[model samples]
Target: MKYLEWRINGFLEAVNFCRFFDLGYNGNRFTWERCRNTQNWVLERLNRALATRDWQNNFPNAKVFPVESASSDHAGIFLTLGVNVICYAAKPFWFENFWMKEIDIKQAVQTTWEHGKGQPIAEMIKSCVAYLLEWGKNKKQQFKAKLKQAKAQMTRYRNSSNPYHLQSFNSAKEAHLQALEQQNIYWKQRAKQHG
Candidate 1:
């Protein structure tokens, strides 16, 4: 209870540091619940909609409310700004640094570039980008499939009672760890690029 209070106080301090005000919501008082229906169950208002004074003034009619969710532990917060907003689609192409580690990436880029010979530089770039996006999509799918397979195999081996399964379990576990490491490297690079 003391730790929870400390955390709540720290959160409030951070909010004050940011100079943001909570847009109080209607409906359920608690936003999150854990171990529901049990004696140890817990409920807390862990989420809030915050806004700067300028933002609040700009959208004075904005309303905030919580929508209870049956599928998730936390309720979803909905905000209405009393204004129409247009949303734009995100850029389709982004070069992932992790792609450089793949053996076929260099060859694939070269092939696409060669295929666009005699074309304008912009045309060649567009072609190469289109090819890379398609290739990356396929690569990502394959990587996810492989990782899923590795996890499934590890789980299967782990549940067996036979001593013979130990070696197989170890191999599967190693493969899973390596896959996770590769995924970690990809995300770390992405974070560095975005940050």
Candidate 2:
């Protein structure tokens, strides 16, 4: 129990110090498994990839998977940090379906389209796209700020032993989880990959 508590505390401190989130896994959860009879075997998740928020944002498609290891008791970690970029002869115009879900998307699109009425079709399309891209940039900045604030709040609660703080921490964690889930879904759709 003491060893477990120490490990937990060490993990929490490392997470806070490095401002990282575990990228989770695609295969087995436990990385370490004692080679013994079922009654005596022990399993623990001892390996993982932890990345900072900026890393998570930059490598949105990054995944941590367990690789089969024959030389050791622990499974090897395979961290894939590849970005998919397709080269095209002619640039294709693509609009996100999620843009319609934003509250200000209609106003922004309408205003941009109206202002470019007299311009050529290509120019007008370009103007509207520029406006929408700016809006998306602003939204991303706002989200990052909120995420930072939540992380700080959670860190404070984690260090406190107070029951009230613990309850608040749980709520904060739940909110963070929900936000991450939504983000994962959006990225999965964009990347055309399964979670």
Every model's TM-score: 0.51, 0.45
RMSD of 1: 11.1
Deviation in angstroms for 94 in model 1? 2.3
Write model 2 residue lDDT over 130-163, tens digit each, in one string.
Answer: 8877787776565456555655576578546578
Residue-level lDDT tens digits of model 1 in 1-195 = 699999989988998988999899875567887864356778899878999999999999998876544246676788999898787977668787767657798899999999999999999999999999999888777766766787677557754656678777778766666565556667787788779
Q: Count of backbone clashes for each model?
A: 0, 0
Each prediction's whole-model lDDT (CA) = 0.77, 0.71
**What TM value does model 2 have?**
0.45
Q: Candidate 1: list runs displaced more than 4 Å.
A: 1-87, 159-164
lDDT of 1 at 157: 75
